[model samples]
Target: MRARHGGPAFRRLILEDPACGFDARDARVTHNNPNEEHGRLLEACAAGDHGALQTLYRLEGARLLGVVQRIVQDRALAEDIIHDAFVNIWTKAHTFDAERGSGKTWIFSVARHLALNHVRRQYREVTVDDTTAEQLDAERSLTASAEIEDTFDWQGRGDLDRCLKALEPERRNCLFHAYVDGYSHSEIAERLDRPLGTVKAWIKRSLQSLRECLS
Candidate 1:
């Protein structure tokens, strides 16, 4: 039977097939611990094991596509981004460092950034002509330079910093890009490679989370 997207059948197909090139030992490990499974799969991918990469895709492809689709709001574009994301994961698999973070998080971040970048590029294309865009780029550089100074001088050593630390890294990054960098929602979305709506929600929820944390 053909596996359906995100369906149990798909998972069974991946998990049950030794021909997928994940041996019996790998299957046992995968069944026992999720993080370890992902880490091992990534290592295998780094070693040029295409089957390992396929296994990873079968495990996470649906969710990754969902995440990208939500951000880009276009199924075709999201699918393209997912394809690119997997290509990136395959190419950059050697760069995966378990000491720094989980493989799952790294994978998701790669896909998320791809989706965000695609939308941001599209936004820039329709929003301005070449001359005006160039002017804006120059202005942004100057503004960024000034903001760098301001960010250091302000010193986020207060409760705010502590509170901000309570947020997920992605959400925290969104806040900094929006408030410190003076980026609009679309700009922040572009910068963070998140969906515009997701960026907005992140900023809003981050603010709320910070307030609660401080209070």
Candidate 2:
């Protein structure tokens, strides 16, 4: 993705530098014709090109981490998603197709969807009597949208940072609450102590503003 945008991991760890097998640019290069290369890589992987799989992992691991990190939040859980993503990519590479989208996109789509689904499915199974627990529950449910949204930093992604940044921090909070924290409008109103209508307006308008700015 567009880099971690200054997460502690990006700054503090020397090992996390994009050059050390975690470059978003490298991922973007393959993403140029993802479906075509995805097929090649998949075929190679299926045919036992361990190096190809490793290339995929090195190129996308951090970006995928950045994407999944936004939704899953917990460092450990985000890492867990990455772990699962690699396994999933390896096993499901055989099923990939160029007609769907670029292979690189599919790789990320598969990884992110699984991570989002993981949190969403788990969120539905919990009890919710206390407000604290309920918020926690709601937070867990906040995950990746079904599509790979233009929300976070995607390498060479459409210009969205300035738009997302134009919003007030609290207004932005609603976006994260829905996309990252998985809270509903009513839940967000309750949490923020504003009118539900106001919260809803903020989210809708925020999205509109973002789309306009990007467009």
Candidate 3:
């Protein structure tokens, strides 16, 4: 980023500017593209260009909701979480650092972490019995999969999809549970009624297959 106080100079180093006062080397930079478009969006946001935020919301809102809904498992609750996520996005827009992460990634991370935090905090210790867990899991999985495209079909990311294709539809539940439903390994086991060992194997092998395929 490049704005002196606020413009393209800000684009070149807004993350490092004293007024912004954040690090140019914040850790998220390692994970995604920290390009100038993010800087432009942040600038637009700071200038009260609501249209900029709306455009971002339009681009990301459906997928973000899909992700959040998968985790929270309640429509009203997920909507509430999305609402909070947008509020956070608006308030924190000025704090975004192009050197830290891509604006798109940053936006998704905010929404995802909010959903994760809510479910983690509220339902962390609630243990359903084995039989009911399995039934509810089946019903929820079917309902969710039927109506939603949760796994991102992930075009052009290389071997991730190819590896995913290797697994049986049901076995893919392991990845879906973690990536989409935010379930832990134990939760996946309980929900799938597969032994914990089996679920663990599926996920381990699935990741291995993905890595090798990508390689």
Better of 2 and 3 by TM-score: 3
The worst-scoring run of ten residues by lDDT in candidate 2 lies at: 144-153
Candidate ordering by TM-score (highest first): 3, 1, 2
* lDDT top scorer: 1
lDDT of 1 by residue, 20-102 (tens): 45343333234747777788899999999888888888788899988787676656666767888999999999999999888
The true-versus-predicted C-alpha distance at residue 108 of model 3, in Å, is 2.0
What TM-score do all the candidates reach, one by one? 0.51, 0.50, 0.56
Per-residue lDDT for 23 in model 1?
Answer: 48
Every candidate's lDDT = 0.67, 0.66, 0.66
Candidate 3 to truth, TM: 0.56
Per residue, candidate 2 scores C-alpha lDDT tens digits across 60-171 of 7788888888766667667767878888888888788767767787888877786668656544533334445445545433541232233433234435667877786677
Could you tell me which 10 consecutive residues in candidate 1 have the lowest summed lDDT? 145-154
Q: Judged by lDDT against the true structure, how good is candidate 3?
A: 0.66
Ranking by lDDT: 1, 3, 2
Clash tally, candidates in order: 1, 7, 10
